[model samples]
Target: MRLIRISTNYPAYIQNFYGQRSALATQPYAQQYQTLMADCYSWADFWTQAFGKLGYEVWEPVGNAEPMQKMWAQENGVSYEPKTWLTDIVAAQVKQFQPDLVLVNDYATYSRSFFTHLRQICPSIRLVIGWCGAPYSGYENVFKAYDLVLSNIPSFVTDFRTQGHKCEHMHHAFNPAILKRIKQEQNTPIDFSFVGSIYRAHNFHNQREKLIKQLVAATDLRIWANMMQLSAAELKLLPLKQQVYDLVQLLKRLPLGQTVLPYLPKLKSYARMTNRPGLEQYVDPTIVARAAPAVFGLAMYQTLADSKMALNNHIDISKSYASNMRLYEATGVGTCLLTDGQDNLADIFEPDREVVTYTSAAEAIEKVNYLLDHEPERQQIAIAGQQRTLNCHTFDHRARYLDQLIKKNLA
Candidate 1:
């Protein structure tokens, strides 16, 4: 079987190609796109490599840069009609290659007209699959354009199926080739660290913000309470404060929370209670300054490998399930993971064995402290987690499952 994988960075690659052939090399946008293409390493790489291993001829066509360039110009306040160069190139490639299966990853930004044009050019294309990461909030119609939709979010799959579209639940997986154990020269320096973005309150990160604040408080209690010589009353107040914070967070998730949300902002003094501080307020400034800046690609693997323990916080959207990529990537690299508790976590990893889960910040702190003090036990769990990932959660495993599904359904 022949397969074609479409990547979001194809336009950047095309821009780089044209930039090299003309004076466009000197343009600022061309230079910027070139840098981005160089840094781009994503799921397309893993999927293509896996399909090739399965003895399928794979063709990856670079998209036309004209539309992307026009979009960039518009973003900079210069209006221009989008060119059809990308669609033309894609159509020509599809007509010539005659792929049995075409896969698109996060292709939401592409215009509907382009997809219609693609269908016109390649009428006999066996199947077109769309892989989605987010919910089907704005992209419901986009999913209809594909023959099948694959999503990590179960709710998204159900929603698509309800709309009479073929959708399947495919969990996030790790690429063992990219995310693997890296032997470090120096010993692990960080006792514990989280390597994900912390967004503002307006986004769906309120749960994360609260959890992080609670963790910060726990850290302070563990490291600074004795140093600062707190009184008995202060020590007693710490747990009480955490309990109250937990109660408030719980109430926010209840139906009563939704009912009060509309009116909560109207009350002046009560509105302040709903406000959540940014990451700076929760984390120690000194720790933040000393922490390594966000790393990507191969450097991320090294960072996880060098850390004694890596932290993971799921967004509020992934209700009842641990559906983030971090679950696989951290464990795949042989790092002892400490993640927020989810209902379906035991289904993925054995609690306190293959991986560790904590329901609250205080529990996370307690587990982290215990794991740090007991090195051998932590190492054993990390090794078990790594083995489990390699055996059941690698890209090769996911690819094989997808291959079977395609053959069974599309046949």
Candidate 2:
């Protein structure tokens, strides 16, 4: 059976990833696809490659690669709107490929109605499969579009089945071939680092941000994410954000508080810039000061390989599950992974042996310091963790399970 696998990138990464490839814009689609295949990011083509091994013809299309999409749209005579642009590209590809199943990895771009609309347009489409690892808070009926919904997070599967939707648990895995794509470091110089999302909308990013803030305060922790890019003016005002907050407290003590009330909103605005939640562009100041420029795809893998210990925290939605990509990526790349304590973590890696787990921010800090100081123990865990991932958590293993899942649904 032939199927299609679709992937999307963060708009920032799309710009960052492709903007560097200005020369590729003038090149043909085949060369563009060749360049795309070289950089192994988030699932990449691993799943479909695994599916290919299991004797299925799978076509993987990156829905957000604009240059390739533009060329294909022109060739296929497909017109698209801004909002529906991503799905438009995928639908056109489905029409071109004429596949039985179209698996969408990005739920943000396509909703239930869009999936419904896809089948309406592409009669060859027999199954619509979706994959999500984060909390899905769209319209209540959003998941109804898919014949099967898959998540690495055990909690997400539980939520889906509890809501009476058909869903399955598929753990996230690493592609060891990623190591071949990037240069290997003989020595890991960075002591502790984190390379993932810091956006507030992500399930537990704020809580993750809090833990990171504490870590930054106490340890030599470094972070890399493109989420917060403050302008010169914003950077100048960061220090003032605290002073403005202090001034507001001082003003509150004055008997003439009524007079300054008109300007309170202005003062509080700067305070919220560093302290409160709604400030989307800024992460915590401590992290902002320590934040390195974002790394993606192969750069991310290289960073993981160069770090002695990579920190991981689950989104609030993960709820006692150790299912995020970092669990596999960090360990697979042979870095000691110090992750938040999860109920199912032992199922994946033996505690204090294959990996390290921390129950609280204080414990995370304590364990991180302990691990960094004790290099032999840490390296042993790293070696064991990588072995565990290589043996059991590669995408090839996940592919056999996914193949069964797809066929069962088809049956």
Candidate 3:
């Protein structure tokens, strides 16, 4: 069967590929930048590589140019309309490649009309599946355009199906080939580390801030924000806004601010900007000052491998279950995983044996300390976690599952 994988940053990948060869010869910094680019493209690269190994004729076309174009548009205060350029490119690829399936990892870039146009061009296309990383409340229309929708979150699958969409619970997996340990010296410097992006203040959902505050106070924790750039000027305003908000709250009890409290909504817009709240707020100032900038792709895996324990925290939206890529990536790299507790965690890893779970900030701190003290036990769990991931949760395992689902649907 023929398949065409649609990636959000294939254009950037292509540019980086050529750019690396020509510019990397003499520049020392070029190699580091190239590694970052590779990390950005690793998701799409994993699936393409996995399917190719299974003997499928996989063709990954640059389906969207947003990654390459967004920064320029943002800096100039302009908008990017994907439909203007993407539709023609995607239709042309469908017409020329005529693949049996078109798989999308980033569905937000493709509109309902774009898929309808692709269907018109190649009516023989068997299926179009999109992987969703979030809930489907506002995105039902987007999923309706696809024959199948896959999500790592189990609740999302149930929600999508209740809304009459064909959805499957496809859990996240690790690529052992991409994320293996490089030999490091016996002493790993970092005791505990957390690597992931912090959500914006507007979309705050998790208890990450609370956990980070406790951890920073208790242990030698390292945090790396997986963001492009965090503005120092914006961060400077947060405390002033927070102080004003606190004063306003204190005034509310005095009967004068109570009348003005209704107008607080108007002030909130300005207040939020000053607050600049997010994961940055909870992190200790010392840690934030010394924190290493974001690392991606191979460097991310290497970081996990070198750490004695890798911490995992799920966002608020993941309610009652853990569903983040870090669970697999950290454990797959043979690092002892210290993760938040979830009801379905045992379904993924045998907690306490393969992975360790924490219910509260105190527990997380206590476990981190205990695990750090007991090196042999921690190493045993890490080895077990890695073995379990290799046996049950690799990209090849997910690819095979997807292949079967496609064949069954086609048949």
Q: Native-vs-model 1 lDDT?
A: 0.66
The best candidate in terms of TM-score: 2
Error of 1 at 233 (Å): 41
* Alpha-carbon runs more than 4 Å astray in model 2: 77-84, 232-281
- In terms of lDDT, which candidate is strongest? 2
- Candidate 2 local lDDT, 154-263, one digit each (tens): 87788889988789999989998887887767678799999998876566577888888899999999898655657678667766765667776666678686477567
| Each prediction's number of clashing residue pairs | 0, 1, 0
lDDT of each: 0.66, 0.82, 0.72
TM-score to native of every candidate shown: 0.69, 0.86, 0.76
Expressed as tens digits, the lDDT of each residue in 1-411 for candidate 1 is 888766554343445445545755445654544443433234535766677788888765435445444444544554433454455555656676778888877556655565676777777678888887654365666666788888887766777799898989887887877643355533676667676545433334557656665666566311111011233565567566555555556666799975775675543333335543223233333333334444554555666777778888776777567778878878988889998888878878888899888988778999998998999999899889989888888778888989988897787
User: TM-score for model 2?
Assistant: 0.86
Off by over 4 Å in 3: 9-42, 62-83, 135-137, 179-186, 201-205, 227-232, 235-287
Per-residue lDDT over 130-221 for candidate 3, one digit per residue giving the tens place of the 0 to 100 score:
88875445455777788998898888788889988888888888887665234554677778998876553333433775577578788888
Off by over 4 Å in 1: 9-40, 59-96, 179-186, 201-203, 220-292
